[model samples]
Target: MSILTQSAAFIARSCARLLAQDCLLCAADSRSSLLCTACADDLPRLPADYCPRCALPTPAGEVCGRCLRQAPHYDAA
Candidate 1:
């Protein structure tokens, strides 16, 4: 590797070590991202069935009733 690349990597590692990145929610060690793997996995995820127009959770994979009656301003969600 080039000298500049090596130097930059060293500096980054030093900074990371000094800063000691940790998960905001769990206070676990996080390498680069804000949240750790465990905390990120525990977060609530959106369901597969959702209204495309309004992006609301729905039983069927279709536009919500409200959106159907009154079309949304934008074409896409």
Candidate 2:
């Protein structure tokens, strides 16, 4: 990453350490981030068998039917 971006992230982390922040979802103490660990982990993740092109859930983990019929502009989702 760029130096400025890195610096900004460092400063943000430092500030989070100094200030007690509440989780945006649960209103619990999150400390270093906007979401508590439990809430963060509870968030939905992409399915393991998702299509690589469109990120739609696929039974065989291959490209979805939509992408196969008409390809997406970009590559992997």
Candidate 3:
């Protein structure tokens, strides 16, 4: 029947979608194909406490001591 044929086509398309997706940032192959899990995990997340100038990780709520005493020579201080 036409209804059964339509159902079959729909099922086929759905199956195709289920097979894979692409990585979001790089447009690379992906198991999920939408910001693949590894790429998502690799994304840089800001730590709670980080270097004021460089944004590198720092001990939570603590400055690196040297940075607190005086601005670096190049800091335009």
Candidate 4:
């Protein structure tokens, strides 16, 4: 990208960072990130036992039944 474009993008991002102090979800005051700490903590997270390839939640570390029966499109995730 051109230097002018890069500078404009940087300035825009800086302005957005300055202006985006409220959480997007609850409109609560956020320190740095888009979401407040409470909202961030409340977000749904994938289980630690999820399949590495398809990211499907598994009881154990082994591949999920579906993936074991039929491999996913991607070789590695």
Error of 3 at 60 (Å): 2.9
User: TM-score for every candidate vs. truth?
Assistant: 0.72, 0.61, 0.34, 0.61
* Model 1: worst 10 consecutive residues (lDDT sum): 53-62
Write down the lDDT of every candidate, Cα atoms only: 0.90, 0.92, 0.70, 0.86
Residue by residue across 1-77, what tens digits does model 2's lDDT show?
A: 99999999999888877888999999999886799999999999998899999899999899889999999999988
Give the local distance difference test score of model 1.
Answer: 0.90
lDDT of 3 by residue, 21-67 (tens): 66778777775447867788998888888776555567874555667
> Which numbered prediction scores highest in lDDT against the true structure?
2
What lDDT score goes with residue 10 in model 1?
Answer: 100
Compose the digit string of candidate 4's lDDT tens values, residues 1-77: 99999999999889877877889999998856799999999999988888878888888867888888999999756
By lDDT, the candidates rank as 2, 1, 4, 3
Off by over 4 Å in 1: 58-61, 70-77
Better model by lDDT: candidate 2 vs candidate 4 = 2
Off by over 4 Å in 2: 1-17
The positional error of residue 7 in candidate 1, measured at the CA in angstroms, is 0.4
Ranking the candidates on TM-score from highest down gives 1, 2, 4, 3
- Show the lowest summed lDDT stretch of 10 residues, model 4: 12-21
